[model samples]
Structures are given as structure tokens and as C-alpha cells.
Target chain A: MLIDDNDIDLKINGKIVAFTKTFEDIVVCRSGEEALNYLKQHLTTPERLPEFILLDIQMPEMSGFEFLDHYKKLPVSFTEGCNIAMLSSTLDFSDIQRAEANPYVVKLLKKPLIPAVLQEVVKEHLQR
Target chain B: MDTPSVKVLYIDDEEHNLQAFKASFRRQYEIYTATSAAAGLLILQNIDINVIIADQKMPETTGVQFFKSIKDTYPDPVRILLTGYTDIEALADAINHGDVYRYITKPWSDLELHNSIKNAYDAYKAKIDLRNKVSELEKTNDELNRFIYSISHELRAPLVSVIGIVNLVKMEGLYNSSGEYWNLIEICSNKLDFYIQKTLQYYKNNKNVAEHSPVEFEILVSELISLYSYSDRDTQFNVKINQPVGFYNDAFRIEVILGNLINNAIKYQKSTEPNKFVNIDIDVDVQRAEITISDNGIGILNDHLEKIFNQFFKSKNHHGSGLGLFIVKEALTRINGKIEVTSDLAIGTTFKITIPNGKAT
Candidate 1:
């Protein structure tokens, strides 16, 4: 799943991820709230939940960090196996540290989801 | 220029002296007479008095004692002490310490009294003006920091998106027709990103308070080397580090220092020389870390060496934002570190840096 407010980023990142052909499907959420809603709606359908979440930190309404706060409150079954990777262009060290310190976050990748990073993600976390 | 009347408060227990002072200065100034130190404190609470003149031989409180008492509360008002020759010794110390701005002797000349009030008020006004300017400067500095952070974020977001699109095009092999254009775009974007990062680094070095953490030189130098490897340069890095004991310093600033120097070493490498190399030697102990970064590159001119640490100072073959070395110097200052550079125009340049361990409490 890819979450970001920018449409251009979403389109570009989505296509890049698809080109890798690592995942079966790519879910796009325009905002953190929409992602939360999608997660809540498919709470009972465990298989429908996203296996990996590529979250953008900066967004309108609910930020990626705020989304993580809400996501943590959801039932463990809904979030148990999912990996939250913070995908951002933030240069602030505090923000980077915050993202890294989050329990649910598996990694913080700099923006423009290149194939090499996706492959590393697959090898490191997804393979297990 | 016609100056406004200086508001003067004369605090004295002697009713006659207060009356004489008011009578003498009434025409030239706004005279406010307080019979005792208590009355002067009351007047100060209610009014904005620019200068306060107090007599030393008061039954309740001496003038120097009154000035000292109101130092924190009525700090804006410049204090003038009136004393006899006998009390000069005590008042001299107060004057030196700046608790009292000036001291006037008893049986004072009208000229001396008038001059003291005028000059003291000027000092008071100058202090206030300087304080206002300092606060304004601080406000502007804070706003600039906020602006830098937000602007960088806004600038980088779309840039990375463009980079993403560029990467996608390259992945699809669509750049074969316009490879040069793509390369140019990539170069420009990378330069823009580099400048943005440098600006943020400068800001961070200025704004952040120095922090102390265990520093591993091998890890830090290697990380910086890898960070600069993305640049399309084939400069060989030969790093040597000896850390016999755990070194403690600001990790962020250490990285900034190493990052900029390492980046410069790679960026300024001799393009024609097939065997371009950078040698980073680090020696660390419990007390300090001494680092030397040398490169076989086009070196800085003797004249340019002194000015290189200056903000926005670029050399002839400048490719950086000109903030790299300046930020390095500033970060060093924060951590109480020192740097020295030696270069021969075409042979190479070497920078020696020494950073002391943060105080262990």
C-alpha cells in the first residue's frame, strides 16, 4: 500500500513499485485517514489487509505519524504482519529519528521508491 | 537635535537636599523628588523614570543600597549616587561593578548635576534601544530557521517526485533518445538537492545545542564515505582510524564535519589523474580526536585558503553551495574543535581537525 497526499508522487511511486513486480497488488491511499478507513473496513478480512505500508510523513488532515498512532490502536490481527515503511524526503534529523523510533515502522526510506530499495525490503522483511 | 526632557528621580532622606535638587534641575528636566528610598520605590512602581539620583547619607537606606535593591526590578533606570568625600570608597566599587552608573558629590555644581542627568539618560535610552534591536534580531533569526525548514521541505518534495519520474523513465530505457538531456536534468537536480542539504546542515549546526555521545570514528568516516559515493566520481578513499578508547562528542556535528570534508575531497579530485585518492586518518583517545583528511586534488590557492571558511566564499572551480566549510567551522566552534588546512595549488589539500571530548560530568 502506498499513502501520500500528492497525486503525482502516488502515480510515480505506484508505477515504480509495480515495475518491480514484487507485490501482487498496490493499494493507494490519498491520505492517512482514508488509509485508516480502508483498514477498518477490511478489519475482518485479514487477507485483504496490506502486507506492507509505504507511508508518507507529510500530508493534509492526518499525517503519517498520526496514522501510525491510530493504526497502533487497531486489533493486533489487523496489523500483526504488516510492515510500515516511512517513505519521506524529510531532511530533519528529529523527524527521521521519530520515524525510526516508532515500533511499527520497519524502515525509513528516502523518497522515490527505487527498485533497489524495494528489493532490499523484500529480501529483508517480506521474505520472512 | 532637541532632546526630550530627561525624567530624574532624586531620592534623599534630607528634605532640604531633595528640595534644592528639584529647584536646580526643574527648568532643564522633569524632576520627581522622593523623600526616602521607600518613596522612590513607590514612584518607580508607578512611573517610568529614566534616571534615579539618590543621596548616600540617608537615615533609612544609603543610595548605593537603594540602587542595588532595585537593580532587578527597575533595571532600565540608570542610577546616579550622591555621596560625600567620606563615602567615595564604598561608592567607587559600586560604580565599577555598574550597579551605579555615576556618583555625584555633595555641594554639587549645577553644571555637574545637569551633565550627569543628561548623560545618564542617554545611557538609559541607548540600553533600551539596544535591547529592542537584540530582541528583533533574535525574532528574525527564529523566523529564518522556520522558513528554511519549511522551504526546504516544499522544495524537495516536488524535486524528488521529478527524480522519481526520471528514475522511472531510465528504468523503462526511454532515456536512450534523450540521454544527454536526462543527464543534465539529473545533474541539475542533484546540485539543487546538494545545496538544499548544505543549507539545512548549516542551519542545524547553528541551531542545535552541542550534544555528547560515544563517537566511533571508523563507523562515522565510513558512513560519510558511502554518503558521498553517490556522486559520479571514481576517487579512491583510503581511511585509517585508531580509537584506543571510547571517544565522546556530538555525533551530528562530527558527521557534518566529516561529510563536508569527505565530499570536498571527492568533488575536488584531479579529473585528469587516473589514480585519484582521498586519505582520511583519524586518531582518537578518551580526551580528543585528531582527524586529517587529505586528497590528491586541485588544491586551494594560498590566498583563497584563509577565506574558504567564510560564508558563501567560493573558489574558481567551486561546485558546492559555499556553505560546506563555513558550516564545518561553525560546528567545530560549537564543540570546541579546531581546524587547519595546507594546500599546494595543483598537488592536493589536507585539512587537520582536532575536536576535544565533551566535558564528562
Candidate 2:
């Protein structure tokens, strides 16, 4: 699943991820608010939940951090074994540090997520 | 304290006093006089009086009374009271009760009165200058913050797009049968290059002074047309110059302004249609030169027209570096020129540029 507010980034990122053909199914949510709404609908049938969720850091109403605050409170089984990654254009060191500090977040990558960055992360995670 | 055509108004009951005041300061200021306080009030309402000098005693009204009366209606001009009366108590009362800026004793030395008015005008100007500077700072601060955010987005967004596309080409077997998406990668790379060039131009515009020289309008137009015409062969440029000779201005800045507008004309052309054309018209005289460029391309939306010149304002549903019109505006600023744009979506966008003739006004 890919969640981002920028329409260009959303469309381009989706195409990039789909070309990789790693994930069987891909879902995109525009905002953290809508992403939570999506998660709520899938709670009863947790199988529908995305295995790997790529969330954009900067959004209108709810940022990636604000979304995690709510995401962590959900029952463990709904998010169990599901991996979350943060995507941002900011190169600010503190932004990286703050995103890394999040326990639910498994990966933090700078934006325009090229295939190499994603493949490396996938490789590292699959090895573990 | 350089005199800067400061408008000075003197009001005294005695005709001799008013004449004497005007005579002394006529060369230094735009001086006006009234024989009575009532007549001075009339002049105040008529003009943008910068500094008002009223004798303390008048047949119709006291200087302080006149100042107090005009306080609300004519408040901008600094008020000075002139008096022969040596009553310190009265002067103190006028200073406290009236909004009298300063009181000058009568049988005045010309030097004393001149210095007093100069100081009052200086103080008045300082307050105005401070307010303007504060607002200008606020505007610059806002632009700086926006520029920081946009630089990150504009700089990174394209590179990521390119990388993502290149990866797809390698992984998706895009080179095989119908690799049309390869063209997209090419377009993406070009867009990135275009933005990089524009960013550098924007930086250079802010840093350097433009070199001025003779600018032949038709020659510049043809050069720009050839430069852009390479990409889109179908696009046509119709150039017209009413006065091309002896027309001199800052060539580099004009190029910057014209280049950006003409580029937009080419870029926004309706790809599906066969008829793609840009019309350039230049009307010049001794005072100012007006250049109009119109395009029958996929025009800008009505809502986006007002904000096109704003820094980093990209019209929704449009893809660009969003600095084209802004750079045009900045370059125009340096040359004391102005641009007017009118566009109708699905029809066209027309830009009319008026630049001062010789040296930048």
C-alpha cells in the first residue's frame, strides 16, 4: 500500500512499485485520515490489510507521525506482522531521527523512492 | 537633511510674514501660503500637505485650534506653530493640549524655522519608512520560507521520477516490444533539465546586474523562435516589430522575460491539434516599448491567472517548475517594466509587456 498526498508522486510511485512486481496487490491512500478509515474497514478481515505500507511523511491534516499515534493504538492483530515505511523529501537530520524513533515504523526512506532503495530494504527485511 | 521637494504650507494673519516665509524657502521646498488660518485649512484639504506652519495668533483662529480642528481630517502633515508671543505658559499649553509638533517663536530667524520644519519632516518620514521596511521584511520572510519548501520539492521530485522510470525500463523489459514509456523517461529527463536551467537563471537574475545595449526586436524574436521551434516542428511563430531600430534596453533581462513567455507558448501547445502558433507584436516609441505575445495553446485557467506571477504558484493540474512567470516578473522589476497577462482556458494566453525605453526607468 502507498499513501501520499501529491498526485504526481502518488501516480509515479505506484507505477514504480508495480513495475517491481514484488507485492501481489497494491493499495494507495491519499492522506493519513483516509488511511485510518481504510484500516478501520479491514479490521474484521485482517487478511485484506496490506503487508507492507509506504506512508508519505508530509500531508495536509494528519502527518505520518500523527497517523502512527493512532495506528499503534489499534488491536495488535490488525497490524500484526505488517511493516510500515516512512517516505519524505526532507533531508533534515532530526526528521530522520524522529521517524526512526517510531517503533511501528520498520523503514525510513527519502522520497522519489527508486527501486534500488526499496529492493535493498526488501532484501534486508526478507533476510531477517 | 537633503531637501526632497517636501510640500511646505505657511499660514499667518500678516501678509508680510507669509511672504517672508515663502521667499526664504521657495527654492528648497514646494511652498504654499495663506493669509488666515481658515484659508490655510482650505489649502490643507486641497493638497497633500507634508508640513504645515501656522502663526500662533490669527484673526479667524489660533494656530493650535487650527491644528486641533484638522487633526482628524488632515492628519498626515506635520504641524508647526509660529508665534511672536513670548508666553512660555501658552506655548506649553499649546504643546500639551494641541497636537502641535513644535512651536517656533515669532520674529523668527530663518535658520531656526527651517531646521525645525526639516526635523519635523524627518521624523514624519522616519515613521513612514519604518512601517514600509517592516512590511517589506515580512513579505521577504514569507517568500524565503516558501522558496525553501519549493526548492526541496522542485529539486528532488524530478530526479526521483527519472530514477523510478529508469528502474522500470530495466526491470519491466520496457525495451522489448512496445516500449513507448521510454519516451516518458525522455520527457522526464528533459523536464528535469529545463527546471535546472530555470533555477540557475533565477539565481543569476538575483545576483547580477543586466548589461544594456541595442535590442532589435525582430532579431530577438526570431532567435527565440528558432531555439524553441526545434522541439516542436508544428509550432509556428508570427513576429511583428513596429519600431526595431534604435530600440535599446537591457538585452539580457529582455531575453529572460521574452524567453520564458515564449517557452510557455511552445510548451503548452495543444499536442492533438495541427494548428499551433505564437504571435509576437512589438510597438515601440521614444518613451516606452510594448511587446505582446499571444499563443493559441492549451491556455491557463481563469482562477490561475491572478497568481501566475506569484513565487512557486503552480496552477493545479499543470506540470512545471512554476518559476516561469515569477522570473519574468523579477526581471521586469529590475528594468522598471510591467507585464499584463490574459488567458482563457481551452482558448489561449496572451502576455503584454511594457518596458521603459532607454536606461531602465
Candidate 3:
């Protein structure tokens, strides 16, 4: 799943389309609130549940951090088969440390995410 | 913002003396005349006078006593005494106790009167100008504080978004078999990472003051070329550094300025063109060292060249926050260095920086 508050620019979306060619399914959400709503309704029925969510840090009403706060309260089943990765365009040390400290957060990815970074992520976590 | 002329208040008990004084200096100054000490004070309440010249003998009060009363209220104005021969002792007391500028005896010359007034006026003007400058600086300082606050808040918002995405990917093992899905996550992550690094560099550049040291020009240029050479391999861009013999300059500031220029040159270098390159030339003289960086890339337009050093000002085609040149300019200014730029669209851009060779005192 690809999630960001900004309507992803054409350059970024083009990159995303090329990336999703190998996946069986692709889902997108505009904000943290919409992503949470989608997950809550679909997780119980097994109709659609994303394996990983590419979450953006900034959003209206519910930010990425606020979404995580709410996500922590949901039943274990909601996240039983899911992983969360933060995707942002920021280099603030405090923000990186804060994300790393959260139990649910898996990794921090920089924007304009390219193929080399995907390979690194797979080598570190999925291959095992 | 034109300030009003300095006001002068002259007090004397004799009506003819008051009229004579006003008639003599009225055209040259903003003059207020009073016949008694009480009337002189009432005039002071209405006008912001710079000088107070009082006759030593008045009907109800001595000149020294009246000056002492108004000293706190008009501390900046130079006080002077107009005394007859009989009041010479009182003039001395006013000079010692009340801090009078000078005493004019009875039957004073017009030239002497004019000279004293001019001196007092010049001193008053200096005080006002200094006060104005200090207040203006305080206003600018307040504005800088506001800018820092907004910059911090804007930076924090994007950081939170990146963290949220990382958590979602970890639990599901979503891209286990999907190479394309993995690529999407990677691209997002890399862009975020680049932004974070650049932002941190910007913040650090603002806060960090580079320690001054003498730097060898040839060695520093070679090191900078090597640092950027690897990144330019795919584009196959050529970089050349030419340094004169025995050339040395302020090392820390030079490193920062060169780093930003080289980075910008590489960033704007067009991918389609082969044989793209950047060149650095260093010339040392007795007084100053001149370093120039020239690049054949997408050059800036005429309008943007003037404002390129302003904070957060970027070209429309560029992707970064537009802070690199601004930081470079600020760092150079701190070291008493100067920079000049020339560019032609589709041709190239060149930046020439001149730094003093000797150690700064």
C-alpha cells in the first residue's frame, strides 16, 4: 500500500506504478485517517489486507504519529499480518529517533524511493 | 522618517533680552523663550528640546537650581549658562554641579553664541541617530527568530509520515516475492532520506561556525573533485581543478563554499549530454585568493541570478529547498569574502569567490 498526504506528484506516481508491476495487488490512501478506516473495515473479513503500508508522515487531522497512536489500540488481529514503514522527506534526527522508538514502526525510508533501496530492505528483513 | 529639528529653550527675566535672543537665532533654530524658571519648564513639557540656556539671575529661582530640576527629564541636552559679571560665582557652581557646557558673560559676541549652539546641536543629532539604529536592529532580530520557528515546524511534519510507512511494511512482509512493490517502497524511502540529509545540513550550516585555519588550495581542490567524481561516473562528467603554486586561504570557509558550489553543479548537470563537466580555477595574489567554479549545465535565467543567494529561493526547474546558495553566501560574508556569478541559459554558470589570504585579526 502507498500512503501520503500530498496527491502524489506524477514523477512519484510513475515510479510507484513501475514498482507495483510485480505485486499481486496495490492500494493507495491519501491520509492517515483514510488508511485507518480502510484497515478497520477490511481486516476482519480477509477481503483485502495490505502486507506492508508505505505511510507518509504529514496528513490533515490525523498525522502518521496520531495514526500510530490509534493503531496501537486496535485488536492484535488488525495488524497480525501487516508491517508499517515510514516514508518521508525529512532529515530531522529527532523525527528519525522518534520513529525508531515506536514498536510498530519497521523502517524509515527517504522519498523518491528507488530500486536500490528496495533491494536493501528485502535483504535486511523479507529474505529471512 | 525625517526627524524634526532640535529645539532650544532660552530663559531670561528681562523681556528685551528674551526678544533679542529669539530675533538673533530664530531662523537657525527652533527657539522657545521664557521670562521665568516656571515658564521655561512649561515650554519644556511641550517641546523635546536638545539644549537649555538659562540666565543666572531670575525672579524666583537661580539658573543652577532650575537646571538641576530639569536634568533628569532632559539628560541628553547640553546645558549652558548666560551670566552677567555679578553672577560669575553662580556660573562656576552651575558648571560643577549641574554639568553646564559653557558660560556666556554679559555682552556676548554673536559668533560665540552661534558656535556654542552648533556644537550642542551636533551632539544631540548623534545621540538620536544611534538610538534609531539600535531600535532597527532589534526589529530585525525579532523577525529572524520567527523564521527559525516556522522552519522547525515545517520540517517536523514530514518526518512523522515516514515513520508510519515503515511500521506497516515490517509486519506483513508485503514485498516478499514482489520486486516491483519492493522498488516502490525503496524509492519513497530514498527520497525521504535525501530530504532529511539536506535539511540537517542546512540546519547545521546555520548553527556551526567553521574554525579558521590556513588551507592548501591544490590539495583541497583535489579532495573536492574526488568526492564528487564517483557520483558523476554514470554521467561521465569531467572535472578539472587548477591551483597556482603556494596558494593558501581560509580553509574552513573555503571548504563550505566549494562543497555547496560543487554539489549544485552536479545536481543541475543534464543527464542527456555526454562530455558534461565542471572546472575549478584558483589564482593567488599578495592580498587575496580568487577561486572560481564553472559548470556547463542548465544555467540560471537573468532574473534569478540577482536573487539566487536569498534564502528559500530556487529556480523553477530545481528540486531542492533553495537554501544551498543562501548558506554559502552567509558563510562567505562571515569570513569577509566576496562572491560573483555569471550565467547564460543552456550554456553554463560560473561563480567566483575572493577571500583574503592572511589570517583575520
Candidate 4:
């Protein structure tokens, strides 16, 4: 699941993910609210939830951190199985620290998600 | 805003003593007389008196006791004690407990009294000014820290986009319309250019002085409105320039101020209102120009008015880039100009800009 408010960012990242062939399927969400709704829809079957989640910080209604605060409350299986990645353009150290502290979050990637970095993430963290 | 005249409050048990103090300082200062400590407290509470003088000998309470009583409630006013002969001990107590700044003897000379009041007000103001300076420094330091993060992010986003597009070119070898890829690069380049230009504009306004030149207000303003307006043509605009004498001002500074305001007027436009409009009137004379920009859009809340000019202060309703007003204010200050804003919630906002206009010599 990819979450970002910017359309261009979403497109570039989607293209990179497609080019890398990192996953069998991809779920794209424009905002944190939509991402939350997607997770809720797949609540019963944790397998339906995207394995790797790419989230952006500065969204309209609900920010990426706000999403984390809400997402952690879900069933343990859903939270534990998904490895969330923070893909943001923020240079704030506090934001980086908070993302690092979250247990569900595995990586903090600076956007716009070029193919080389995507290939590396798939090889290292997402590899079975 | 600093008041033109110093407000002095004199308190004494004897009405004659209060009259004497007021008579001496009335020409130089705005003097307020209170016959007793109780009366003086009332005046202090009601008025922003800069300095307060008290007589040591009184029926109900001495000057030291009175000063001590009001020290907590009215700490800003500079306190002075007037003591008679052999009241040196009371002066000591006033100094230690009451926080009295200066002591005037009962038979004080006119020159001595005049100098004391002037010095007391100056000392009081200096202390307050220092405190204000410290807090302002701290605020700017904080904003600079936040700005570094924001600027880095803004700069990095575009560079990363270009980097990602380059990776696509490497893998796929090119798209059917390579122009599409080139367009993305151009967009990123323009975004970066805007950030660079705005940041430079902020520094230039702050550090460097601008040259005065003949400004064709009508043409310059119309060009600005066109540049900022969206291509969709949603918001209607009305511009009126009454410039019989072609205005002379710092064109760069004016551009910065007008550009930011015009951009905001368009960006935070009312979505529900069909006939959304922006009205601008520029009236220029030989020495000054007053421009008013009004918009029927989502107005700022009354609380955020004071802070809108502050760096990185964005309204809760409108999540703007947050640098626009800061730059506008900076440029205005450079050109010795001022801006005033009034807004009605859900109705609209209006900004009044006042800048000096002189012939290019």
C-alpha cells in the first residue's frame, strides 16, 4: 500500500515500483484516511492487507504520524505482518526519530522512490 | 507602538505635593496626580502610567509599603520614593523590598527631579526593550531551525523527482512521448527555481537596499495579477490604478509584496462562492501610495491576524507555503512601507498597504 497526497509523487513511485517488480500486487492510497479505510476493509483477512506500506508524512486531514497512532490499535496480526516504510520529503529530525521508534515501521526512505533504492529495499528487507 | 509622551503618576498625601510635582513635569510629560496611595493604585490600574512617584510620609501607608503592595500587580511602572530629612532608613527599605529605582529628597531641585523622571522612564523602557529583544531572538532562532527543515524538504522533493525520472530513462530507454518526461523535469526545475527565487528575495530584502525607479503602477499591477491567476480562470479580478503621475518606488520590493498578496488571494479563494472576486485599488501621490487588496475568500481568523506576518505562521484553514507574508512584510520594511489587514470570517479579507513614493533622483 502506497500513501501520499501528491499525485506526481504517487505516479513516479508507482512507476518505480512497477519497474522494479518488487511485489506481486500494489495498492495505492492518496491520503491517510483512504489508507485507513483500505486496512479496515481487509481487517478480517490480514493476508489481503499489503505486506509493505509506503507512507508520506504531510497529508491533508490525517498526517502519517496520526495514521500510525490510529493504525497501531488494530488487530496484532495486521500491525505485525505489515512492514511500514516512511517515504517523506521532511528533513525534520524529530519526525525521523518518531518514525524510527515505531515498531511497525521498518525503513524511512526519502522520496521520490527511484528504481535503484526500491530494488535495494526489496532485496534487503522485503526478501523472504 | 511606542507612545509619543511619557505618562508620569505622582502620589503624595498632601495635595500640594502632588500639584508641585505635576506643575514641574506637565510641560515635558503627561502628568497624573493622586493624593493618596489608594488613589494612585486606581490610576495605575486604569492607565498605562510609565513612572510612579510616592511620598514616604503618608497618613494610611508609607511610600515603601505602597510600592510593595502594588509591585506584584503593577510591576512595569518605574517606582521612586520621595523622602524627607532623616528618612534615609525608609529609603533603604524601599530599595530592598519595594524595588524602588531612585530617591528624591523633599527639597529636591527642579533639575534633579526632571532628570530623575526622565532617567527612570528610560531605564524602565530599556529593561522592557531588552526582554522583548531576547524573546524576538529566540523566536527567530526557532523559525530558522524550522525553515532549514522546510527548505531542505522543498529543495529535495524536486531533485528526487528528477532523479527518479532519470532512473526511468535508464531502465526503459525512453517513453513514446519523451516530451512527457521532459515536462516532468521542467516542472521540477520550475519548483526549485521558485524556492530559490523566494529565498533570495527574503535575504535581498533583509540585507540589501533597493534602488528607486519609475513604476508604471497600472501596467506593473496588471502584469502581476495575470502572473498569479490560475489558468482555469475561476476567480474574477478587479484592478484599478489611479496613477496620474507615474509612481516612483522600489519596484522589486513592491513586486514581492504584491506578488505574495495576489498569490494568496488566488490560492485561498472561496470554493463555494460562484462569483469569487479580488478587488485591488492603488492610489499613488507624489510622496506616498496606498494600495488596498480585497478578496471574497476564506478569511483569516481574528486570532491569527497578529501572527500572520510572523515567519512560518500559516492559517489553520489555509495550509500555504507559510513564507509569503513573511517575505512581504520584510520587503515592505525595507522600503519603509507598512501593511494592515482586516478580515471577516467566511466573508472575505482586505489588506491595506502604505508605502512611500518619491521621484527618482
lDDT of each: 0.87, 0.81, 0.72, 0.82
lDDT of 4 by residue, A1-128 (tens): 88998887887888888887768888999998898898999898766788888898878899998999989988887776678888876544457888988887877887656577767876777757
lDDT of 4 by residue, B170-215 (tens): 5676744666866577556556645655665665566446778888
Top candidate when judged by TM-score against the true structure: 1
Give the clashing residue pairs of candidate 1, or none: none
lDDT of 1: 0.87
RMSD of 3: 12.1
Residue range B1-361, candidate 1, lDDT tens digits: 2878788899888888878887887888888988888999999999899999888878878777788788888889998888776665677767765488887888899999888888998899999999999999999999999898789878989998888888988998887667499888887887888888888887788788988788888888887888887764588888899988888889999999999998888888777889999999999877788999998889999999899999989977666677999999999999999999999977899999999976554
Cα RMSD over interface residues, candidate 2:
3.8
Which portions of model 3 show Cα errors greater than 4 Å? A1-128, B1-143, B146-211, B216-232, B235-252, B284-286, B302-304, B310-313
The C-alpha stretches of model 2 lying farther than 4 A from their native spots are A1-128, B1-184, B209-211, B359-361
TM-score chain B for all models.
0.88, 0.53, 0.53, 0.51
- All models, RMSD in angstroms: 2.9, 17.4, 12.1, 18.8
Per prediction, fnat is: 1.00, 0.54, 0.04, 0.75
Ten-residue segment with the worst summed lDDT in candidate 2 chain A? A119-128
Candidate 3 per-residue lDDT, tens place, B1-361, comes to 2646658899999999888888898877788889899999898888788888898888789789898887787777777788877675786688777878878887778889889888877777788888899999978866665566457546544443353344334334664556677657756654564554455555555654555566776677668767766556643334343444344444655776887788788878877667777877777765788878888888989999999999889777778667778878988887778999999977899999987766544
Off by over 4 Å in 4: A44-47, A114-120, A123-128, B1-47, B56-75, B86-103, B107-149, B173-361
Instruction: Give the per-residue Cα lDDT of candidate 1 at B312.
Output: 89
User: Quality of candidate 1's docking, in CAPRI categories?
Assistant: high
Q: Please report how far candidate 3 places residue B45 from its true position, in Å.
A: 24
Per-residue CA lDDT of model 1 for A43-98, tens digit only, reads 88887889899999999889999999999999997677898899899878888999
